[model samples]
Target: MIEDPQGTILALFAAFCRVGGCFLVLPGFSSARIAMQVRLFLAVAISMAVLPIMWDTIYPKVSGPTSTYIGIIAIETVIGGVIGLITRYYVLGLQFAGTVLTMMIGFTGPPSQDILEDAAENQLTNLISLTGLTVLFMMDFHHVVMRALVDSYTAMPMGGTFSPQGALISLTDALSQTFTIMLSLASPFILYGLLFNVAVGLVNKLAPQLPIYFISLPFLITGGMFLLYFGISSLLEIFANGFVPVFEGR
Candidate 1:
């Protein structure tokens, strides 16, 4: 039989606080589409699996006074939450880029249910977000998340003093880097939109009587769709490459 069952159990629970908090906002895993019960159980499973490895690091801080233990849990939760948010910001950047893409490409369809989230979104944006997330999953992004969480124990140990400034700095850097990468990925479309709109404007100026905008609507959308079809592979490829940079920023 295992000795000190109470200590072991407390350690497991402590580990859960961190892993659960992280996955709570994790991109695909945290989607509203995923049942809360599934998330809870998955978090518990991960905690149990990792607790043995993290026993030395986690068990000591968990054995203090009740108030101290509560504080430790709170601290660990924040650390985990911050780690998750870092990745979440990158995903949000992709969604934001997709939104911009839809507007630029003239795929401004009416709002529809987002397959990935509960919020309303353009269908094209939904398609792009879903595809990007799926590719990330296929690339084993969760493995990266789990590895990062494990390393976080060393970076921000349990019961350690939380630095609000450091957290803000890290969050700010993640956002900056994520959007930079996203803009790079979306640059081709942005340029296309610019050139296409400029041409449309010039044509409208040359023929004031013509309904240039209305005439160009179908062509604009059709051209953007064709560009999307051709460029999607490259767009997602560049995005997948950016995951390394995001983690490096962390």
Candidate 2:
């Protein structure tokens, strides 16, 4: 093959560092379940797949004196990190919503070691995090993540540096949107828990000697599960819907 070895190696390494660094800390990929070595390989594989397609255009823009090229590479890495962080923070919204739901369901406890991810999470918190990730994969939302990485190069470009103020503003807007979505996603469970607890409290007041609160444990657990089952689909749909705009920052 007629190939420029130096150029190819340079392009490969640059792309690897940029993409790998982003994925190393990005949410789903960064989960405790994925081994660091596998994540590294996946990042390299992604960069390899993308470089051949993008390098023809990207290289020209980045071609310049050594100092200029280095600066461009740094800025591009930062832009990649920004995009990665947006998706990651969106996932955090699910975790935040889970935390709120756990509090409402009376599962408050000292942080315990989680089995699935081997992180410290209350039982309900772990369930929600795992479920959210499962739903993301099932809905092909990760494909959107790859697309966002590609689109970022177009929006931000290879050699150009975005204004720090503008990027900060975008980050702030993304966080706000994530918070709003989290509240909305958990609203059904939130309302249900509130009413259920209030009713239980009233009942307990009326029958102080009857151990009504103890009697309601089974009902509360059943009600919570049913409510979650009914609302889970909608929650996933809402998450899928919100995925794109945050990535595009539109």
Candidate 3:
């Protein structure tokens, strides 16, 4: 048997598709803070690390025509991308919660650059999202996501039939679950904001001369801050603890 360089290259590239595809959109790994070249190198390194374990499954598929090779790469990239998307959905959910928290606390500030992406965001949401993602990293979210990738191979075989319907269903399911989890995490703040706003509205009705919105702003913000100070710990703790399970359960 001849050792073929082309065959070897194809197999490696196919492996890279999955690993790199995931990291391309994976929370911390995909952060704009990290240089693109660095991310590329890191993805290559991780793909190499796992290539040995995945070689038997991947190499067999890439030993084909040039057109077939292109198809294989596309398929692998899509597979990896979907897995990454599901993982990312959870992180994004935290951002949604942060938006809710900001509205509830009435903590409006000038928009700032987001640490994760190239976008303008309020400071409170920015802080919550950054903190939540940081906590997820500390909790080894990469390991879990990677593990899920490995497991995904079993659920979806290498170079087998691709099911758009299945992928769509999975993505929809993830979105639904992520929203539910985020809402649950932000519920307390929602209730607080509702009651506080109602009271402010009542006061405004009683004294039309008073600048109720302005007068209540400090109290609203202060109460919110106090609630967050005491409850933030538990809120984040619960979110971090349940994230993996809730995501994996789906």
Candidate 4:
């Protein structure tokens, strides 16, 4: 077998581009704070590590030295993106829960300083996103991402076609689950806000000029902080328990 060095280089380059592009958008791996050079190096390292294993199975099926290579690259990019998107969807759900709870506790709208995006945002959303990302890394939930990365090639191999309908359905399912979790986490704060609002309304009715509504803000904020402090452990535990089956496809 005459080893075509040009073909080998092209194949590696194509694989690198596809895989690297995917990681550029993947959560944990794709944070803006990381230097571009460092990320590129990491992506290159990943490609080097995995490509040899995949090339024998992947390269033979792919078309040779033409527009077909471009097509294959595009396909791989899509597959990698889908793998990253599924994980990101869940993280967004956790952030959404935090944002909702913050709003319920009267921390509504944008603030002057936002830690995550470097732009104005609801402080609570920013806090939640930061915390969630930190916790994700701390807990090594990134292993699921790595597993998904490996499984991606199995699920949608090189030169293998994508099932648009299946991908759409999967994305929709992930989003739905995210929304459900968000609501579940935020429910306590929502209930607190609702009950407190009603109570305040009743109290106002009994004494219109008592300044009860204005004075209640501090109490609401304080109560919300306490609830969050207490509920965080349970919320994270639920997230970990639920997360196991999600990537596992059980």
Which has the greatest lDDT?
A: 1
Q: List the residue pairs that clash in candidate 3.
A: none
The sequence of per-residue lDDT tens digits that candidate 1 reaches over residues 1-250 is: 9889999989998999999999988999999999999999999999998888888999989889999999888888888899899988988999999999988988887899999888999998899899999999999999999988888889898888989899899999999899899898788789989999999999988998998888998998999999999999999999888987787567
lDDT tens digits by residue: candidate 2, 1-250: 8367767766776676568757866877877777879988899899988788788656675456889878867776777677677778888888889888776665676887764456688877777777777777787776877777777667767767667897788888999999999999888778878998899899889988888867886687678778878877888788878877776763
What local lDDT does model 2 show for residue 102?
A: 72
List the global CA lDDT of all models: 0.90, 0.77, 0.85, 0.74
Give the better candidate number (2 or 4) by TM-score.
4
Top-scoring candidate (TM-score)? 1
lDDT of 4: 0.74
Instruction: Estimate the Cα RMSD of every predicted model relative to the unseen true structure.
Output: 1.0, 2.7, 1.6, 2.4
**Alpha-carbon TM-score of each model against the true structure:** 0.97, 0.85, 0.95, 0.89
Instruction: Indicate whether candidate 2 or candidate 3 has the larger TM-score.
Output: 3
Cα distance off (Å), candidate 1, residue 36: 0.9
lDDT of model number 2: 0.77
Q: How good is model 1 by TM-score?
A: 0.97
